[model samples]
Target: MDARRQGIVEVAARLLRERGAAAVTIRAVAQEAGMQAPTIYRFFEDKDALLDAVAEHVFATYVAGKAQSAGDLDPVADLRAGWHTHVGFGLANGALFALLSDPARTRPSPAAEAGAAVLRARVHRVAAAGRLRVPEALAVELIRAAGTGVVLTLLDTPPEDRDPALAEEMLEAVLRTILHDAAPVPRDDATALAVAFRAVVPTLPTLTPGERSLLTEWLSR
Candidate 1:
C-alpha cells in the first residue's frame, strides 16, 4: 500500500476508535491525516471504501498480535487463548465489531478474511494433533458462529445484567462439540455416535467410495 493510503487508513481507524463509525467520514479522516478531503479520493473511492480500509487496518493489527502470541503452547491451549482474546477484542470495540458483522456489506473485508485465516490455522493445528473430533472446517464454523453470537448477545444486554459466565461457557460448549476429549456421549446418543463414525468413514478401507458417501449422507441427516 502507498504510504499516504496507509496513513489515511490509520487515521480513519483512530477516529473510529475514539468516536464511532460515523466519525470516520472522508473529510474527518483527511483532516486527521493532514490532507484535503478531495485527496482522500485518490486512495478511496468513497466513504464506504474508506471505512472498509479502516476496518482492515484495525483488524490486521489485531490478527498480527494474535499470531505473535502463539509460542510453546499446545494446540488446544493456543486455541483457547485465541478464543479469549477474540471475545475480549470484540467486546472492547463495539463499533468495529458491528461494522465487520454487517450483513448489508456486499462481502467480507480483506482483514475479516485474514482474521478467519488465523482461526483456521489454529483449528488446523488441532486437527493435525489428532485432538479435533469434528472436521476442521465444521469446527471453525462452529467456533465462529458461537463467538459472534456470544459477543453480540452480550453487547445487547445491559452490562449490569449480563451473565459473566456466558462467553466462557459458550467456548467450552464449542470445544466439547469439536474436541476429542469432549464430554462423553451418552449410550443413547445415536446422533453423536453417527457423527463420530462419519468422520472415520473415509479411512475405512473396506468401504467403497459409494458406500462411504452413502454412509456419510445418512450420518449427516
Candidate 2:
C-alpha cells in the first residue's frame, strides 16, 4: 500500500481503539488523517471497507509479532506460546478483538483468516508429532473456540475480579480433549494411537484411495 492509504488505515485504527467501532466514520478518519472525505473514499469504498482495512492492519501487526516470537523447539510448547499470545492480544485490543470475534460477521477478514492459518499450521505440527489425539481441523477449531471464549469471558469480568489462571485453565481443558496424555494405560494408548493414525491417513501414500477411504470410515466409527 502507498503511504497515503497506509496513513488512512493507521488513523482509522487509532480512532477505532480510542472511540470504538461507531467512531471510525470516514469523515472522522479524514479529519484525523488530515485528508478530505473524498480522498478517503478514493482509497476505501465505504465505512465497512475502511473498517476491514483497519482490522487487516491491526491483525497483521499482531500476527507479525507472533510469527517472530513463535519458535519450533517443541510443537506443544509452541502451541502453548501461541495460545498465550492470542489471549494477550485480545485482552489488549478489546475493540478490534470484538470486531474479529463477532459471529454476526460471517465473512472473516484477511487478518482473521491469516491468524487461523497460523493456528492450523501449529496443529499440523502437533499431528505430525503424533501427539494430537483428534483430527487436525478439529483440534484447531477447539483451540480457537477456547481462546476466543476465554478472552471474551475475561473481557466481561472486572479486572480486579478476573482470575489470572483462567486462560491457562481453559487451554489445559481443551488440550486434554485434543492431545494424547503422556504415559497412558494400554487401553487408552490404543485409542490414542488410533486417533493419531486417523489424523495422518490422508498423507499415507502406500494405501490405495479406496483402502484409505475404508480405513478412514472404520476408524471414525
TM-score to true structure, per model: 0.77, 0.86
User: Which residue runs of candidate 2 sit more than 4 Å off their true CA positions?
Assistant: 68-71, 183-191, 198-221
Model 1: weakest 10-residue lDDT segment is 182-191
Task: Name the best candidate (by TM-score).
Answer: 2
lDDT of 1: 0.82
lDDT by residue (1-221, candidate 1, tens digit) is: 99999888888888888898879888888888888999999888998888888887778778998888665588889999999999998988888998888888886888778889888878866665556666667999999999999998998888899898999999999998888673343346565566556656777999888998998888777
Write down the lDDT of every candidate, Cα atoms only.
0.82, 0.85
What local lDDT score does residue 190 receive in model 2, on the 0 to 100 scale? 61
Q: Runs in model 1 with CA error above 4 Å? A: 1-3, 31-34, 182-221
Which residue pairs clash in candidate 2?
none
lDDT tens readout by residue for model 2, 18-92:
999889999999999887899998989988788889999988877887666555448788899999999999999
